[model samples]
Target: MKSNQTYAITLVEYAYGPAFSNAMVYSGYYEMTGTTAVEYVIGVIEGPSGILLVDCGYDPQHEVAGRESRAQNHIKYQHPTKVLKKAGFNPEDVSGILLTHLHWDHADCLECFPNAKIYVQKDELFGWIETLSMPKEYNTLKVSVDICDIKECINALGEDRLVLLDGSVEDLFPGIDITVAPNGHSWAGSLITVNTKDGKYTFTGDTAYVKDNILGGRHDGVSMPNGYNCGSVKNVLITMQDILRLAQGDMNKVLISHDIGVWDCFESITTPEDDLRIAYVAK
Candidate 1:
């Protein structure tokens, strides 16, 4: 079924930093050396329904405190609102936010859009809640999540602004649909596909970090999984295969939110102040 509406998609780069090569690809240390520059991004979809965000970028206000960090070198951080405003869009007018997953980097900034309804996989929420409840020895499992973000979701639930999905949903909004890949990158990772004026583009959250994960970089014809997986590596493979199938074998149609290479594939404009970018995927 096709929606009567089509959107103009934009990829917003709010922050960036160096990421370990191995963190991007499983056992990448063997063949990959040095850190690769990566960006933290969010997807912006504009259509007749309203301005919708794929995933909210991380919140600077809650940066991991008092810790010597390895991946904490992220810079040029800007709230989605400020970034959107600098790019000539009204941040306050956001109507909804489709959370691909609840990793702190993706969902911590939800408070920025107070009036927007949040759509997330119910299993994603439940999975995190269950994991967070485990003993401190299981802390490794909780590394990528923020308790505050979960609290914020709970608050949204109380405010009637959270829409939890049991699984996948088509036409969540006109020209927009959500696909949940249970136990993929994170505990219940998911991706959103936008049928836009140009074509259908899939905004893959953290499920597939670099093209190598989907396009087979390890060997001539094999897809490699990212290094970190809160779920299982086997599930990661399944999710990526599903992503490739959804893209219909066209790697160009899949937008890897963290990959720096995305800017090269699309026409992107950088904001003057923060040096953030907005890539027009469809317009």
Candidate 2:
């Protein structure tokens, strides 16, 4: 079946920072010569149904902590709402948020889009709660989990704004399908595939850090697992393999959330001040 519906998929870079470390971008397979950085982006699918954000960017406070903890050397944080406005969108115009998982960087902005319903994996919500309930030591080691973000998700749930998924895959909207990552980079991580006029575009939210994780590590001919797998290394590898199959060997169709190189892969627009950049893949 051919989809008459089309979407202009845009990647908005709301924040960026020096890579967690040289190893983060290069993976351990390659030598850490120096530090590199990665951009944190939120994917936008604009279609007849309105704007559907794949992941909402984080709050600015987290960027401060991120730098203090050495999680990143520098951070340039911008409110997703403002960033969206610069992209010609209003926060109230958003229809839904397809959250990959509840990591702080991806879900902290939940309150920013007040009118949008959140689409997330049921397992991811419960799994994160389970993690939060774990011993302080264990939870503290998982830097990706932010208590404030968890609270925000709980608030959304309480407000009955979450459309939780129990299954592995679901047709979210016209020409859009979201598949839960097999094991997931985190608990129940998700990959969103959009059928645009250009072709199927897959947004692998942290499931595959960069092309190297799917194509094979940069220097070595082996696939490397993501650094922060609140799940398991084995699960990450399995998920990576699944992502490859879903892409059907079309590299351009797979978009990794944190990869800075994404800016180069699609048609992009930069704001007049050059503070924000949006890359699009569409007809």
Candidate 3:
């Protein structure tokens, strides 16, 4: 049986990255002029156990190799600790951290939370290891990943702070379950579902970048795949069907971490001093 408890989830924006080209966001969107600014966020899940985070924002001080250089307009608004405080919690208060994938933007800041146990998909790590083992000519396959970050995750495992799930998990923590979209966005993208007072809200971290990928393609009764990914497009569409099933065709119930439109669609609070915004997923 699944846990009946509910949690309050909030999304905290820590920084804003470079604008994403349309082709990079929407599959088959070949237009070059159209672009959209994306928000880098961390999902805060508060429940009976304590505060848990969906993905920790990256560390600006140590820019990892292979990551695209931040442009002049790229903003590092606030450190994760300060931003979390502005959002009403301390870094130390985070009891667990759920990583959607090991991309630099998502998993590089795990060290910030001293007391939290980190959870990641087992295959996500192995897939990167396999990529890293490939020949030099295949380097493009891992441009978005940071070897240092992967090493840090391995170190956490050695220290007993990391839990690698083989596949989808139920009641990972009370009211919080995890579902994987393997070979979709990354090696294994973990889509999180948190039960709330109103209903269940699913946090999609790169699995579905925008509304169209999950909600569009309705005429064909299938999902639209993102243009940018590290895996097969066919598998991406297949994985999206799982996300769509979880959402039950309701776009409002899906929380897309990278989409700025989420802020417009939900009740949000912005702290100018910290230069961060919090979108309430469930009150």
Off by over 4 Å in 1: 27-32, 63-70
**183-275 per-residue lDDT for model 1 (tens digits):** 878877667888877778898888777787676764455777776578877888888888888889888999898888999999988878667
Error of 2 at 14 (Å): 1.2
Q: Among all windows of ten consecutive residues in candidate 3, which has the lowest summed lDDT? A: 65-74
Considering summed lDDT, which 10 consecutive residues are worst modelled in model 1? 63-72
Give lDDT: candidate 1, residue 63. Answer: 52
Candidate 2's residue-wise lDDT over 1-283, tens digit each?
Answer: 6455778888888777765565655446554556556778888888887889998977756653354434464455668888888887899989899998888778878888888889888888888888878886785545777777777777878888888887565456878887887445788888888888787888888876677777765535477765666677777777777677778878888998878778888888877674668887774
Query: Per-residue lDDT for 250 in model 2?
Result: 82
Compute the lDDT for candidate 3: 0.80
C-alpha lDDT values of all predictions:
0.80, 0.76, 0.80
Better model by lDDT: candidate 1 vs candidate 2? 1
Q: Give the TM-score of candidate 2.
A: 0.90
Which candidate's TM-score is highest? 1
Q: What is the descending lDDT order?
A: 3, 1, 2
Query: Ten-residue segment with the worst summed lDDT in candidate 2?
Result: 64-73
Model 3 agreement with the true structure over 217-278: per-residue lDDT tens digits:
34445466765488988777777777767878677888888888889987998886765788
